[model samples]
Target chain A: MTDPLPTGATIGILGGGQLGRMLSVAAARLGLRTHIYEPGANPPAADVAHAVTTADYTDTDALRAFAQSVDLVTYEFENIPTAALDTVEAIVPIHPNRRALGTSQDRLTEKTFLQELGLTVAPFADVTDAAALEAAIAQIGTPAILKTRRFGYDGKGQARLTSPDDAASALDSLAGAPAVLEGFVSFTAEISVIAARNPQGDIACYDPGENVHRDGILHTTTVPANIPARLRTDAVLLAARILNALDYVGVMGVELFVTPQGLIVNEIAPRVHNSGHWTQNGCTVDQFEQHIRAIAGWPLGDGSRHTDITMENLIGDDMDRVPDLAKDPKCALHLYGKADTKPGRKMGHVNRVTG
Target chain B: MTDPLPTGATIGILGGGQLGRMLSVAAARLGLRTHIYEPGANPPAADVAHAVTTADYTDTDALRAFAQSVDLVTYEFENIPTAALDTVEAIVPIHPNRRALGTSQDRLTEKTFLQELGLTVAPFADVTDAAALEAAIAQIGTPAILKTRRFGYDGKGQARLTSPDDAASALDSLAGAPAVLEGFVSFTAEISVIAARNPQGDIACYDPGENVHRDGILHTTTVPANIPARLRTDAVLLAARILNALDYVGVMGVELFVTPQGLIVNEIAPRVHNSGHWTQNGCTVDQFEQHIRAIAGWPLGDGSRHTDITMENLIGDDMDRVPDLAKDPKCALHLYGKADTKPGRKMGHVNRVTG
Candidate 1:
């Protein structure tokens, strides 16, 4: 028989942003080692990881060596190239699987897959070129968004269409890239359900967090998200259905629009999500550790919330206010030590637990 | 003006155990780096620290290089040899100062210092030999204790004298080392006050925790300790007094015996303590992070506890119960990745919080 994995086995991560940074911290806490693999230059997750590899993602030789050394592979972001994914998966298990990656990487397929499950999704159509863009706009109507099917996050590579006349210019904005057009849903608020699926087919989901956004960057997420109990159950059920369909084996973030009629699927992220940051101070176990446990085949931790929590993101210059905010006995401030305070960068967050 | 130290400055730590391991995790959270300087081989702290210097504490070359490279020095244990301490302090700023170290290193001096501060301490006298022990026991009376002057923890260097007949044997058991005789104070319970003081003279203290010990090793600490409000105030004030007298900087643990009359000071430790581990899951700021902020000259964090907490130490064979303990919704299990779980080793701890 192959060697049984040890409890302190090393886990290799392929992206080194805030997600990876938090993941590395969680891995260390659980008596496991983490090796971060990031492409070139930025400090990213190296500050806290046990080891780091700063080679290009496309370097086949380095990729092979990395896969050979680690017992398992997981990534923070889903934009990993297909070739790099194959190289690593050949030697070790990659959680979320190739099928989930292919579906989430392309918007057209993700929406179609959700529709097949009889789950609610915004009306959408694939747009291959300018001619197709106009036809899709006619079918989905005005007041919509046109987003590139792959490599988009935090509102990047997407443009809103308020009028039919702007369809041609919007297509050019994406530079003739494969895109999807979807009619906008007039929802009252946005909420996210963070769920984790273990390799043993057990699933656990945290309470949905009602989120607020500013300039497409997350501003705050508060638990007991001002939604009806029915809505909350539906959100969790929808997430479970998606994870089961994809055979997901880690934490997946499902964003939903709470409309007057019901909840509609926005998209799915096959990794940890920012909306669950409140768990750092509010729950028995935060999402990061839960993800690591699920991927490692360890038993899942309790995801129960101990108190009502409010989490606010520290964007850009807001980090300077840390000293003033830390004095409040109710707030737990966490600042990501990014070297620069450029505009729109997520510096850190603060969690306030109300008894 | 002297240049301000950068955020990622190296901090040299003198011991490499669970305390140092926890401190290293805290330092990483602040974007700072830690280099542990320990005399033993394969220390637990080496698993997570940025660097480790494994050599005899008396190795001048190793100590010199460690001191030169680090910006400031702190220690996990109070028993560093005087010569070794002098070499390191000559190069970098050692926080909690040498005065604190000298007082804490010996029982006789520590008691004398407490008595001078008008704090209640068990009556004690110096014992140089068996004859002095007999005379000291006559003054302090039976049911007293005889202990070595330095390098004792977990009941390792002390013997209890239940009767006059036990005094001679107890003194002989210590191998004629320098010792102190102490009278036993009638105590109802044991408690600990954890506090931090910065170079700027700012002090923050957490509420006292009621502790239970078995075989002289801490077994559990419960927050919102069953003590009167006035007792907590006195504990805090006593800690602050010791800190100001020593001109201390960094976290300090002041252990006390809660008598029906009032709280009596027993001993003080100049480092993060096991009793305060509940803060990891129950408070806005943990004791480990508070220690780092104090040493880094950063503003202190909030020290409020929202939920009632219970922290249990997982000693030696207790590690085998992790699988069952991890499944508890209220338990936040933390296991240090030590390779061997020999008897008396601090394998890990678990923090359970309840509203």
Candidate 2:
């Protein structure tokens, strides 16, 4: 078993967005300091992190310096550049390993890996060219999503095909990027399981949370999801299977589709997920802390929910309701210290304890 | 009514200790940035704060520059020098006001103020010299405590006078510094109420927590203190009265000695107190966030306890048990990233949720 990190050790985080911001706060709570590395100036995580390095990931010197300054490294996002990883890995250990990141980074790889584990996932086919896309669409049938194999988020870098006739235009919209065509599953509800695994191979999974999205962006996540008890148990087991398969160390968010058939895996986030925000107010040990503990080589904490919570994202103009939300005693508001609020921007979120 | 400060505003914190560290984390959660000001180098709060100014409180130029950079000023401790307050107040508004700090800085002033407000405080007499100490001892009788009037904490600068024969030596033990002789109160238990008040004159109080101390330092605080419903209501009202009298804006900890007759005011802290740390796990909005909201001119959040929580201080050698504690799912550990752990030094705390 790996020895746990001592207090006062620094953890280098690869992103400086809200996830990194929350992770930095969690690291501080555990007596660990965070050094945030991002190319953007005045990133949100810099406000809470112990240190920040503003340099491009491609800058080998900056990456090496950042790695040497910390005991371990973790990334807030899965799409970290391979070159950046190569530079940091030589100096410090990165948790959730490069394999987990590489597998989750590409749609084709993730689907193949899940299938190898005997997990239920939507039928998907790799489409590297227009000819490949045409053949994949014919086999997948109508009403499918063609998503880029990498760097796709918040409904970006994706195109929907309503019928076979629209396949040409849909493939053209992808701009010749390698893509995957996934057959749409008729799911009744969307849910996600936030799971963690320490280096010792101990695993813990929080209860599944029902998710609601608007315009392909997550709007809210409610815990004690209105699913059957068996489904909940299955959701957790499937998440644990993925963690064990990857030999993962850190928190992972596994999004699933609840259908007439069993739960179908949608995607996996190798870091703290937006759907897991409810755990902040509902669980004794939140997902952020769980991730920190796991990456630090500590025993996994209990991810059991103690309270029922509904987490609502305050995107863009939704900040106008902050004053009203602040007045509500049950709402715990978490706002990212972003200077400007643009449309569809996730400015913050509120976790309301319903019970 | 004061207009609420906009998001992304910077809050200046005076002391960079664990309280300041927690306050900085809370401020960031509300989309606010914290600039910590401390005379000590490498203070604990610097790890999480957006900015840190390491300069002496006596440095007028540094204090002015620090205050000018933030929208408002608040403090983690009450013993700030009068000159430091004057310099900072000239640049930006300081929350909880100067009078509140002035009243709580000295034992004599705090006792007098509480008594003036018709609260029950132990009988106290100012002792400036040996002659004054002798007279005060005669009036207060034996089994009283003699403490320095200012700059005393965690039972420091104190002597117990069990009998008349010890009075001369007890007076000399203080080394001729100004002091106060206070007759001890016989009480059944000790409790404290964490209260907050916004600039708009609105107030909120967390349920009183039963406090246990070891070596004159807080050892543990359990919420839903074993008190009668009537006494709980009385505690909240008494705390509100003190906040209103001071015209306080920010959180305050009011310690009370529960006697057979009623609750006697032991003392008051103008900032977040150790006894209020239980709220971090038990309440929707913790004392740190409540203080930030009050200072930012926002509405007070609900202070109702949803779960029973007992917060235990991890002092000095107590950190040795962290490895074992990390295995317990119910124990939420919070550690200050201090390099050295000395006896009586608060290294961190754990909030264990019982319900």
Candidate 3:
């Protein structure tokens, strides 16, 4: 096993968003510094990180320099380009590894990986062309969702077919990009387990949180999710299996669908997820710090929930209610330092201790 | 009343130590930026702050430039030279106000202010010379402590008088500097109330934490301090009175001696106190965030504690235990990014939730 990182070591992060901002703060608490590699100017994480390099991922020179500067590399977003990873990996180690990122990046690959692990996933078929999509639609039946095989997030690059009549238009909307046809499952509710694995293979998972969505974006996540004790245990076990199978050394968010037969795998996020934000107030070690600890080769922190919490995201104009939330005794506000609040933009979040 | 600072306003901190580092992280969570002004070349707070100005306090041009760049100014250390403050106050507002600093800067002034407000304080006398020290010792009696009137911290600049014979040596040790002779009180325990007041006159106080000191330095602070309910109430009220008396607009740490008669004010810190560190895990709004909120003119957060916690300071070699502590489920370690660890230096702290 790798030795833990010494204090003051710099950790390189790939994306510069709210997750990176929060991760930077957590890393600083542990006496670790962060160097952010982002293409955009004035990224939120830059405000708190030790250093920031504003260069595109394709810049191998910049990537190599950034990787060489830090002791190890990790990323906030999972969609890093493969070539960029190869360049960074040559100079420094990246946690959650390239395999984890690759599997989660593509819908078809993620489903196949889960099925291979004997975990129940949505019935899915890969579509390389119009003919392939048509054949997959016939096999999967109507009311299936056609999603771009790669790079789809927050409801983007997805087309829903209500019946067989809509399959042709849905396939046409993909613009010839690779796609996946997934048959819908009737889920009672959606829940996620925020789990972490250290370099030593130790695992810890926080209590499942029931997630609610609005306009295809996460709205809120309430811990002590209304699921049976058996299901909760199974959810945690299944998440641990995935982490161990991937040889993951960081936090991962595993979304699951609760159905009559059993829990079905929805998807996985290779970094700290929005659904786990409540851990910041409800647990001794939050998901951001957990991820940092894992990537830095430190022991995984206890992820037990001590307080029942409800986490609500403040998207776009929702920031207007901040003044009132700030005065709330039970609310803990976490605002990302994003200047402009455009529609659908995640501006901040508040975690309220309910019990 | 001054309007609350809008999001994204820059807050200038005068000192760049651990207190400033934690404060900077808290401010960022609220979408506020921090600019650190430190004379030292690689201050710890610089790692997480939005900007840092490395210039001596005596440099009027640098001080002026730093003040003008931020919306408001605050300091982590109380001993900032009055001249530097005068220079900065000309350009930006400084919270906790000038009076709070002036009063707390001198032991004589602080004791006098508490007495004038009808608050109980240790019997004290200003000692200007050897003869005055002898006279004060005679009046205050043996078992007294002679401390410098200004610029003393962490038990430095203090001499203990075990009996009348020790007075001469104690007085001689002062080297003719202004001093205060304080009569010792027989106290069962020491506790501190972390309190805050906003510009709009809103006040909130966290439950007092019982403190233990070793070698005249804080060792641990356990919340839900083993004190009677009535005394806890009195402690909070007394702390609130001190805030009101100062018209304070920031967090203040009020140390008190739990005596048979009543609580005696030991001293007050104009900034966040080390004793309040347990709030990082036990309270919804920790002292650092409360300080930022008050200084920014935001409504004070609920200072109520939800979980019982014990905070232990990692002084010098105590950092060796961090690896083990990191693996503990209940421990939340906070390490200051100071590269070197000298004896008696506070390197970090850990907050453990007991219940």
Candidate 4:
């Protein structure tokens, strides 16, 4: 709305994880600073951000002070409490808007929204009770996943139903929360499109990267995904449609299941995604800077891939191999400075240029 | 010497300017935290460094406290006070070693050391007084430069001598400080090689970059310099020779004069050079990270150039052009985040990928 943020303006980030850490570094690259607000002490972003506020999201005083100190606000995660958004929105703008956040927070709403856009999504039915679950299973069939409609990530808060006989226990697993029954999507491969749009309606999409997950955690994302040209175009176009629909002002990650029929929307993240980390080495301007530029009202950069890169997440015990990884010229290590690396934790990532 | 610094260990930087700011960012990339020791308030490095100790370099207590907190110490500039190094060195190690620092601090000592290494150097004479200036002028010839023996950068603390008649005024301009009068060489171009070495004697050298200056301040440095392959190899070998001679344990910027006879050593910086900023975009491992890895005792990364680049400094009013520059996808901007820009001050730089 106002002029683009000046060189010294501060961008307020609402989370202090690796994404926030990378965002803080990117902001500093653009001659801007960042203030991180999080509930945890000694968050990963604390080492690099210009300022950090350690307070619960419900703390109105910290939220007000942080909003007042920054020229603009953006977040690293969706599912922020409505009250927290209310406390900050009254003070300053939050990019990717509440509509996108609200839609992505609940699985059912997200699927319905995508279907309405004339895009392919996994067949789904909302379940409110045991009877609804039975009817939905009869309609969508078995081998379906019953996911909590709100607050789920990394394989958490979900159960698998092999047959109708397992429906009651699956619903019980959700602990009385609203849920969605998504029929299994059989596909050849999975890929993600990282897209960005500015406040001015300008949009840019990075090359879709094929993804591989282990134990439901992202393991590797290789750019120039092994897909046909037609599918690549469809992936990018569908992603643009979602960005435009949300009127997004920052980067978003759109995960897709590549079926023979067409690409099906799996999920969407309203922030920079782990799968897009390859941009740090493969493009002149990476996703972090792109998000900062878009949210700061600056022109979007060219997202054309200049090199082939494979971004591999270094989880938990992978830290032990860092000395060997550091010796390789092609591997660019990006560690998050997490004090302790527990099992399944994303300690860092390595962007290895293949060519 | 003991072991490569762990993920959470801190690197204490001795200055808080743009070089230090960049080094801090690179240190964070390797999961290492940085503690910046700066005398000025609100230093450019303060916005990104993990911690900052603001006190004069002469403050022994502050220096001791800072050294005790960080695992290792490294500096951005060569002229750090001996006492400060003494205070820190008593507690922790300083990279590039004090000998390298001591040798590069004074122009006379630096030139003598290079000549002793069997390196080509400009004809020179030490001028202790006005009579010595006249004597040196008579020996080195008419066109020469009278420069302070210690603490000179960016053409500061020097006066040019066109003829014997101007000797008094040039000497008067330098006051009573010890000086050096050097005969100017008729060089075809200026090139710099950024080279690094670790404690184990492993070395890596970046390709030579040709430099251009305006008003005695560096303006641009282009990689794949317009020189024959033989000259390039000579420049790099000479740089490695210097690094090996000093038993260096970090990055060094070696400036050379390309002449008909051979390569001539102009001077050396015991830290990352401005010309090497091009590596940020053109190479997988940049000079900043190379220095951090060397000081941390990690293996040196490949310094191979992957793209052709020209780095241009944006001085003072150049900050006004950032908005337009940001629109160019090929140009990556690196700003210093100085609060105010005075004429001729280094506000930032842009690395344009030429090929």
fnat, candidate 3?
0.79
TM-scores computed on chain B for all candidates: 0.97, 0.98, 0.99, 0.99
Candidate 4 per-residue lDDT, tens place, A193-249, comes to 999999988999999999999999999999899999999999999999999998888
Kindly report the docking quality category of candidate 4: high
Off by over 4 Å in 3: none
- In Å, residue A254's CA in model 4 sits off its true spot by 0.9
> Where in model 1 is the C-alpha error above 4 Å?
A1-6, B1-9
**DockQ winner among the candidates?**
2
Scored against the true structure, residue B164 in model 3 reaches a CA lDDT of: 85
lDDT (Cα, tens digit) per residue for candidate 4, span B264-318: 9999999999999999999989999999999999999879988899999999999
What's the lDDT of the predicted structure labeled candidate 4?
A: 0.94
Q: In model 4, where do residues sit more than 4 Å from their true spots? A: none
Looking at candidate 2 chain A, the ten consecutive residues that score lowest on lDDT are A1-10
Kindly list the per-residue Cα lDDT of model 1 for residues B1-355, writing each as its tens digit. 1232344577888998878888887786666678899888867676567678999988999999999989889999999999999999988888778998899999989999999999999889999987898889889997998889999888888999999899778988898889999899899989999999888888999999999998889999999898888988889999999898888889999999999888889899988889999888877779998898888777777577777999999999998887777667778878777778789888889997756
Better of 1 and 4 by lDDT: 4
Residue-level lDDT for A351 in candidate 2:
99
DockQ of each candidate, alpha-carbon based:
0.50, 0.91, 0.85, 0.84
Better of 1 and 2 by DockQ: 2
| Pairs clashing within candidate 4 | none
When sorted by DockQ, best at the front, the candidate numbers are 2, 3, 4, 1
